[model samples]
Target: MGHAADSVTACLSKGLGASVGTIIAGSKSFIAKAKIPRKTLGSGMRQVGVLCAPALVALEENKAKILAEGLNKIKGLKVDTASVQTNIVYSDILKGSNITETHLCKILEAHGVLTMPKGPFKLRLVIHHQISESDVKYTVLHSESCNWVHW
Candidate 1:
């Protein structure tokens, strides 16, 4: 897991650097050619002390628990592990014709199990520390009872 994470991070860093370099080069060329003044560009920085402080603290405190909960959700769903890399998980419903993805979302929402519709027939579940194993079980059971065909 550590090795895979490291590889993903490395790839992301390389990709990010390449993208930033391209953006910077393009912006510089555009600025120089257009003679756009700095003030006109609105590229000013302000001190966001409060926002930065909490964000830093949240990253330090909540990252590990969030990752663990995500793994648990993936395991509970028993679907593609790759889709659980981040906090979001996507699942397809193959239930009855009238019970569309939107209908399923409405059902879950009415039961306080909020989810997002992905496509015409896809639903997205996001795992958070607040959601427990029992919650996952209840969600799955409810979905199954509704005769949702899993994809």
Candidate 2:
């Protein structure tokens, strides 16, 4: 399980590096600072080629899915921006409505959508693998239902 988890983490880190047009180098410099015994700390798993194999497989299988999800999130953000009528859509809304982003997030969660409040009047809607087109529409509709007037 540790090997599997490490592999997944490594794969993800690599993917992140690639998306940003960065290269990841294999270095052991960071391991030198470890004070814990290898056997007891399970750090002995380093340099295990077998674990890397599964990580590689996971990366190949999941890369497309991850990219698609990212695209969906970008689309959701665009939708949110287009639907906004107020300039202070983030933190100011919270101040006037007496509702925190977390509270609104719960509301969205109940509606089968998920979001985070950015500031007092600002909120951020995050689209994930589980969110569908209908979910995005619902969020837009729900946000539109709110009557926010700027003073």
Candidate 3:
């Protein structure tokens, strides 16, 4: 049921919980061409199975939904919950609000929550295997109580 593409690259280090490595797949001719860069960079796939093992475990988890849903309830932020299918969550601060992504990130950081400012009004959050349910709850609770957003 997956859509077909000419070439695909999957980064195993981030969402997959792998320490390192990216898997690129394509036609034989495409791979043959890609090998030039791989060999030039001294990249090897030998013993990569050990790094790939954690992806199996990470695939079974969907902790981002728990965090996204909780964040959606905050008064000034809007989270498109349906679009969250992986470990990444993107939230937008509504226009006319007196808050920038950087400001929001600082408030979150002061409360021990770390988030990345994607744009003036957009913040990005990543949920990995290390993020627990309690961590999600604490983030949402603190975010709501921050009271930094003002239109």
What TM-score would each prediction reach against the true structure? 0.45, 0.34, 0.77
lDDT of 3 by residue, 65-143 (tens): 8889998988888999999977899999988768889988989999989999998799999987788889999999999
How much is the lDDT of residue 82 in candidate 1? Answer: 47
Please provide, for model 1 over 33-144, each residue's C-alpha lDDT reduced to its tens digit, 9 standing for 90 to 100. 5335644786433344643454344334333333333323431232454445544567655434445668779877877778888876667776553455577667666665
Give the top-scoring candidate (lDDT).
Answer: 3
Q: Candidate 1 at residue 88, lDDT?
A: 55
Off by over 4 Å in 1: 1-79, 95-98, 148-151
Candidate 2, residue 17: lDDT: 24
Best by TM-score: 3
Q: Which ten residues in a row have the lowest lDDT in candidate 1?
A: 15-24
Stretch of 10 with least lDDT, candidate 3: 44-53
Model 2 lDDT per residue over 1-151, tens place:
3443312123323322222221223335534433245456653544445545544444444333322333234312212333332111222243455555566566657766556677654565433323445654666555444432222
Q: Order the candidates by TM-score, highest first — what do you get?
A: 3, 1, 2
Q: What clash count does candidate 2 reach?
A: 10
